[model samples]
Target: MSDSLAEHVHYLGLANRSDLYRSAISDCIAPDDTVADLGCGVGVLGIFCLEVGASHVWGIDSSDAIYLAQETVRKAGLDKHYTCIASSTFRAELAEPVDALICDHIGYFGIDYGIIDMVRDAAKRMLKPGGAIMPDKLVLQIAGVSSDACHEKAAAWSDDIVPKVFHWIDEQARNTKYPHEFAPGELCSAPVELGQITLNADTPEYFSFEAEIEITSSGRFDGLAGWFKSHLGNDVWMTNSPLDPNGIKRSQAFFPIARPFDVQRGDRISVTIRARPEGNFLAWDITPRGGPTQKQSNWATTILAEADRATLDGPLRLNDNAQASQYILSLVDGQRTAAQIEETVMRDRPDLMPSQQGTRNLVRDILKRCAVS
Candidate 1:
């Protein structure tokens, strides 16, 4: 194994294995049962299970930790019953279904190793119907707040320059890769670091989860960190935070301001995260420090025509209210031309008229995108 995998395996050395031990003891494994250890790391948890009387253990990992696990198995004189494979959970290549599956290869936000999805798929293909899984589910939670410091930090890091020098530089670097991953959208304004994440779990089911969070910063909130919860079974819950409690630190997905607005302190920023067959999405809000007076997307109402939507594709993150999306939607009847739709929409929604020419131009752009091949 190379040094990189070795280092990755060594990370298990830092894990607080007390949770694994407790879960193993409480779950009640038989003397001759089989276990498949996913993301086995140095195989400490699997080795620990053998110490506690498990009959057979198979350890799998993507890192160099498999070598360490094999060494540990050999030293313990359990070579017959304990084995190690240096591979990912998605391709463990094991021949037999096991009685239990053990995995702790999760990051702060929980899906970093792609192990959760792997395990979910594995349970469907590899495990027997009566088998148990340890550390099953994880959950995420969030709160909102206002802060000058957070705003300043975003401004400092954002690409909002007045004279346009930085914008040109940004354009040059559009195709270049960064040391870290950047979001799909351009940075319209500054952003704030929402919070950190922590891990907590161990139970039945392939996976199971919950999160409790305290929000510190608040603003006219635009986006948020993705938090998640997994349920191992009805019994165990795990939490994944963008504000990671472990040393693993990386950026969270950016949540753009659905509508531009002002936010204040003490506002409750509440969010819930769940999984779907497709992918993950989040809905969030910040209560005005005051009462409900104006909706957040009022700027959109002014700029968007009934037949238009914004071109949110690039740095500007334009709104669809501009007659883009709706115009295309309207064109489906094939009876009305783009110009006709613009005229009708203008008549119905006068608020969209910054000017007549602008409306015509917006409609023209939409029709251009909707032009059939």
Candidate 2:
């Protein structure tokens, strides 16, 4: 099966995940409500809205999965109530504002997946004033772990296994986040509520917080684990926390340290987590009282995929694509239609333009960034 097909199948097969989403959508959506499923994978959530009597449903996805979503809705005889938008959230334009917004962008660690940015942008541009958002609030939790494998996994830099010239690769591996494979029972410290997230006018571009974890059991402190509790309104809630019985069937993100140390009951550890503006770059510091701190940050260890230093440090200049982009964006004035703008670009900037098909993609790419609302 294709990647998208396999993803949809996995989502559908998740135990109790769909049932909970169906319940949440049904509770908030009314018969006359128009719902938009932002990042709708296979439009499963959009179909749920239709089954619950929504007047119309919009399935918005950045992938070709939207095509399959259209087919799925048609196969269910619910095509009349649904429309597929084959665009990313940045480029998607709705005929009218939606009454509710639902999405699947929330990652295992909640805010790490960028639900804040998606919800904030969607609410400002596409949602009605009083629009209801599924899983409106999220609570982030953190805990200290005691796992043999977690520490062993991070201390992977061996002369036999890897050469000294490529030590940087092992360093990057140590700073990266891994899927939490261990259970909650391995927790050395009680899970503490690090922060909460709700997208609104006042929400920050990314999350930053620090908290203290009090050790509850005597064990080796290997690393830190992160999870989330999501409130879907109407008394419905779900979590990916290993400790929560009703957590969605998903793995949490575990941050491992290079050296594992012993901690006794009542010991304290200071934990700090930070994210870049878009939440793509993550960093954390785990420090034990009176001991050395182990810092794990993708920005610190990884060079290639991290932010561009030149852009941040100096005056930048736009290239040819940017010049073409500027001309295309100027046409996005309040008055001109998309078709009208396309025709104008073809006539005026033939030198900067590509072939018939490439021109369309170029124009669409340039203007979509500014197409809020």
Candidate 3:
């Protein structure tokens, strides 16, 4: 690989925060536990797991970085306990059932690299039933704004590709910098559903999404801001355009931003996002065709707490809100329990126990409604 490409891959190995991952796997580890790091990418996280006393650690990656990870293992003299595999996550075989799975395959907005879905599938095949995943939760957020700095960076693409941003992003791959930008305080922390990434994979090759979004703030919005915030356990997490670490930036975690787009106060900007698999990640396009933009796929709710609601065409019935409605919805996927969800919410909003209770109740109610639907 060229020096820059190698640098980017290597950076991925070191750039991530291992402390968060270490703390996450601590609870799930046993002396003889078998662990698999999906999309291992140079095996830094796996190394940390081994250091913390995991018995057997396997790191899997589709990229060339698997070799680098192997070298790192040998250099660390960990060859006996840690193993590296150079193959696509979907096709890899394991020596035994895994006790836990660690995956940080998340990309900008959580879907670009198909990591989340990969996690779900890998977890299904590799992990023992009830085995935990490192990141228990992930969320995507969105907002409206035209950013000049963002436009300028995306415009720096080579002559081999089109100069405009947000259209056919795959053609702009030469620009190593990830395209797309987020404006200050412009994100709507929307609730998301699982399968956001998997649905795209099932979508026909020529697929797209269009929506109307009203700009809440008047700024030169050259494009939309999309990002994913992930919590590795009950305690550790990271966010693109993070609210805690101002200016730490998400480190190129966005895609398909528009170029030199302009917007005014009360202006409704219509936006569309398109995607297809390219290389190891999903390639996409974002277009502003009209009004306030709709939320991006990653930012929108996928599995609604009320998705199973039974609808009656006969009449509009006013259903009373109950605690069960929310509770059931929260537990629909079997991925999270009521107590776990409560703990997560409490960590983020410590003073809102009542609100959390109400939210959980509503979730159960929604699930009940969906079940009857």
What lDDT would candidate 1 get against the real structure? 0.50
Candidate number of the best TM-score: 2
Checking candidate 2 for backbone clashes, the offending pairs are none
- TM-score per prediction, in order, is 0.50, 0.81, 0.58
What digit string (tens of lDDT, one per residue) describes model 1 on residues 213-247? 33334335443334344444345444433333532
Candidate 2 lDDT (Cα, whole model)? 0.81
lDDT of each: 0.50, 0.81, 0.57
- Candidate 2 to truth, TM: 0.81
Give the least accurate 10-residue stretch of model 3, judged by summed lDDT.
Answer: 188-197
Who is ahead in TM-score, 1 or 3?
3
lDDT of 3 at 346: 53
Say which candidate scores most in lDDT: 2
Give the per-residue lDDT of model 2 (tens digit) for 189-219: 8899998877545586556889999999998
Off by over 4 Å in 2: 157-159, 305-373
Model 2 residue 199 CA deviation in Å: 2.5
lDDT of 3 at 111: 53
Segments of candidate 1 deviating more than 4 angstroms? 1-10, 13-17, 25-28, 145-262, 265-373
True-structure RMSD, every candidate? 17.7, 5.5, 20.3
